[model samples]
Target: MRVVLSCLLMLLFVPDWMGEPRLPLMGKRAVVRAAPIALDAAHPARSRVGALVWLGGVRLTSPDRAFGGFSALHVARGHRVTLLSDGGNIVQFTLGPDWRPRAIAFGDLPAGPGTGWAKVDRDSESMGVDPRDGSVVAGFENSNMLWRYTPDLRRALGAAAPRAMAGWPGNEGAESFTFLPRAGWGGGAIAIGEQAPWPGGTGRAAFRFTGDPVREPNRGYRFSYIPPARSDPSDMTVLPDGRLIVLNRRFTLPFTFTNTLVVIDRGAIRPGAVVRGREIATLAPPLVHENFEGIAATREGGRTILWLVSDDNQSVLQRSLLLKFRLDAPGTPGSARP
Candidate 1:
């Protein structure tokens, strides 16, 4: 009886062992080495009007507004840009002739079970648009829910579409996702989670979905895990070469830490690929406003440009900062590469 009691106590008191390591905290006073650049003003990367443009650091109107929690910002081939707010709102901003945001429409997302408008409970993180059909897929934070919307968004604008994917274990919040066009391996989709259960760490994952969206079990889908500890990945973009560039934010005191950029080679990720990762760039709090969340890649005058944004949390101390960088490759920038 004593042995049995001891075993129970051990189970209760132990740290709940998981296979993954705990994410490290960025200690206070970490300097942000990257310089801040104005997003609206003309610069080397923004001089051309017809080139692909990347912008960030726009302030939110209110604390409840999704402006600060910009999790996903995507530009389609036709020059259409859609931004998804993690704070339960989807804002569609049309691009003008010069690639700048023209008209903006704001709408609420269908509330799921155990969700609220407040930051403490809201989800709705990353989003992807179907290149072939213009359909939308959104991933919810703190829940294992993946929603799909047909091109008829006007009819089902605020309504939650059918669940296309699920079954993520733990408090794993699906944050960002990008789709690989039908090239090979059946044209798969890649997603990143803020954190996972056994791993007790944050990382990015890649998935291959069966063409069918309605059937049970969703056959032919697989996951490739990339372990980047203490790195809460909020967004991801796939480069032309197939490498994944992940934007990660660290937590030190609930809402403060350095933001990091990581690059994972295409071959390094596969089913059960050991999940190790390397950090290429670290953005200190001072360099960027609080809560840098979204990231995207585009071409500007034959140069590859990387854009990053911050989630201000609607706090006075924070500002939405959009910064741009010129990249030679996924992990080749001097500020980002180790």
Candidate 2:
């Protein structure tokens, strides 16, 4: 009887992740329960056309423990999106006519160079898809490394830790990883650190890798990016026209959250140039904000669509939110055209 009691106590203390990882099933579909959420309680389901016109938003919940903690997002080909979580899981789903998630699919990264057991081992904070072949490059924070996967985001092809990104303060590493279409003088992939300040400089450290960082780690150049005051860079997306949209996040006093969207010209991104985005829109209290960590952009007929998602931090006090917006002023030089 004493042996049985001892076994029960051990089971109770066992960490939840001691079980198998929930890897993505290629053809399987999962369901994500969503409740319609308003961008602002006063304005309700809509946002005004300033820099970004609010479309609508939803609070997503799932019985699956693997859900939430979304760190980065990518609008892939078709009407589908690929979301990476801090838990080392990947969720792919198609959007229906009503802007709700449909045909959901989920999986874990098969394996990576870190080989750690916890989610932080795979802590994939950022992702960029290769347009030519649909391949993907994911940046893991705790490990301070990047891994490339096939288009389906299931298999690991290669991995690398760029020499320039050494000692990047662990959890702050690779917060924003993106691909700019013929960007820079010769074009390349870029990764920015969330809390890593530039050496002997201000702002954050951003790196431009000439080729695929996972493929060619030797060709990396460092740059500087200054986000809004009291905020840290979270995620970034390259627009269809080669513009860069960076997402900045802040945790205000009394447990409030704020987010800002800033745009930078494609021409401003040069070696050693300190690039600062033009603040176009802000998301704060009464305007629908959480730990808005992920951002992605797509172009419709005559409009540019933006999607913002929040990380619940897997905490009961927080919530997971997915928001949609449309950029109304693309030709404007700075900020949103009023």
Candidate 3:
């Protein structure tokens, strides 16, 4: 009886003497904000829509094997959505009635080393398509080279064509690009590069080039002070009002988030003038994902709708999230475009 009582007393008091206390079984919950007005509407052609679409919280082995790391996407002339994988492979998928990828076709990357220290080894990052000719211009990450492919995409299949542009200064790896029209310069393309090991910190830079791949002076300027700290400007799109919207990734140790969307005023930027920018909105991370890299904007009805996508980097801790948002024009002074 004495032994039994001693053992029971020890079991009851030993936990209290321990340095760490036992944790309670408290359940954790995620908070979901109320749906914005624009996203609440049901019509497919509503003025605007915004929602977060969970893209399989993990990488799909079969799909990724067929597509590689799909980092860039564009809507082609035929309404076909072309996805460019980081492994130098392009996949074309037909948009379904619900605006999802379907009926996929595989394609190839550019040939030959266009620029940088060594031959281009296929680090396709972002791409821009010529609306007039259907040709594709792809930017490689490490090589800092721009490659122009024929509309047929066959010329780039072989390793013989000369590089479209070469020997760009600084570690400006081309990441995002778009086409803009100018009066005397004709229709030119604007390419944006991500942060690299350069003199200045990683910031956004813009370049203007003629449609011809052989043209010299691919004339352009760099916007030195638009992006935020540790921001990896990944993708860009033009707003209806002729402004530029840049999506940036906020990278920190062990965490990546889509924290800011910058808007560059149309009048502030010129052919050679450096312009400042302002952050219009800050996006919330999807559940537990990071590395939001893709951005697209389109006008529905009369409102501007922004779309975003995350790069999972093939890590189990990350996921690809397709999110949408409607731009709410801010009335405050700081919200004004720079």
Candidate achieving the largest TM-score: 2
lDDT of 2: 0.80
Q: Which residues of candidate 2, in runs, are more than 4 Å off?
A: 1-29, 183-185, 331-338
Per-model C-alpha RMSD: 12.3, 3.6, 15.3
Model-by-model lDDT, in order?
Answer: 0.54, 0.80, 0.54
| Location of the lowest summed lDDT over 10 successive residues in candidate 2 | 20-29
Put down candidate 2 lDDT per residue, 13-46, tens digits, no spaces: 7554455553322233466877887767886645
Ranking according to TM-score, highest score first: 2, 1, 3
Question: Per-prediction TM-score, please?
Answer: 0.66, 0.89, 0.66
Q: Could you tell me which residue pairs clash in candidate 1?
A: 23-230, 32-284, 56-322, 57-320, 57-321, 57-322, 280-336, 291-311
Residues 210-326 of candidate 3: C-alpha lDDT, one tens digit per residue: 544324334444444357766767877666567777777777665656556778876666654554567765554333335766666656557666656556664667654445555
- Candidate 3, residue 75: Cα displacement in angstroms equals 2.3
Runs of candidate 3 with Cα error greater than 4 angstroms are 1-68, 76-79, 97-100, 110-120, 151-154, 157-172, 182-186, 196-202, 210-214, 222-225, 286-289, 328-338
TM-score, model 3 to reference: 0.66
